[model samples]
Target: MTQDIWTLIVVILVFLGILALMIRGWRNRTRSQAGLFDSLPEVPAETGEVVLGPLTGVYIGSTVAGDWQARIARAPLGHRSAGTLTAFTGGLRLDLADATVWIPRSDLQTVRRASALANKTVPGGGILVARWQVDGPDGTTEIDSGFRADDKDTYPRWEALRGDAAPTTRPDTPSSTTEENK
Candidate 1:
């Protein structure tokens, strides 16, 4: 009985040590990412008219643009959570379970299809990647945030957000219409 107790204690100690190390590593990563926190845009008081969404999905997380593995470790950026993606005349809003991320329309670069981003892996073309730029102390950083819809059919509709469908700005007066709403 004593021998078993000693072995169990040793195992527990080892596990706790590993846990501590992991916590320390994550803390360091968050600190290293502090600079990026300022670059994230402030959530708008209003997001304007909804152009698309209330699309249900998992927010796979964001990363330095083009580097699928380099997850942004800043608070709220590097974590996976259930989320709703909405497109508005103002831009895109990621209503994450834990945090809300607002990306202005002007910041959008493109929206693409992807399978892997940050630490999450889904099937090919399972994720919608919104590539956008954020201004920071380092000039501008382009980042890609991934979202996977619960309904697969929603993918194409979200993709439309990248093209002519997602206008960067609400037209003061849409040329198509005789008089656009201000």
Candidate 2:
């Protein structure tokens, strides 16, 4: 009887241990997914259009009007992926490993020059974050384009692509020019 009791306790303890490990893994995966995709809306179907490079960048999340910042877990360190941004005649399509975000050009509010966007700092010449709105089941939400090309200096070309909506003033931040010297 004593040996049976000890065996039952050991089995219970082993089961509890496995449960704890499973919970930990699930939490970790949830955090990683949030970091990668955040609250981006669904990506539209990819047409055979080719406008922008299959540029790889760290996609943060959709931007709201207020000071809604990116979650710390969603920082570049935790969430980083090589994604492609394709510009179609109708809208822009962003394809990442974790999420797909499609924004119609009509919804594009403005393309601005940012020193730091959603906690991620664009070192060399800063980065351009395009703000757009999408109407979804969660209502209308503004999305921030968190794309920084491998070549930081290519922002001007991207700005031109946006036509007159792009900001006329270039990012003249001190840090923007600092990296060029290196």
List TM-score per model, in order: 0.83, 0.54
Error of 1 at 109 (Å): 0.9
User: At residue 114, what lDDT does model 1 achieve?
Assistant: 80
Report lDDT (Cα) of residue 111, candidate 1.
78
Clashing pairs in model 1, backbone N/Cα/C closer than 3 A = none
lDDT of each: 0.76, 0.54
Pull out the clashing pairs in model 2.
none
What TM-score would candidate 1 get against the native? Answer: 0.83
> Model 2 scores what on Cα lDDT?
0.54
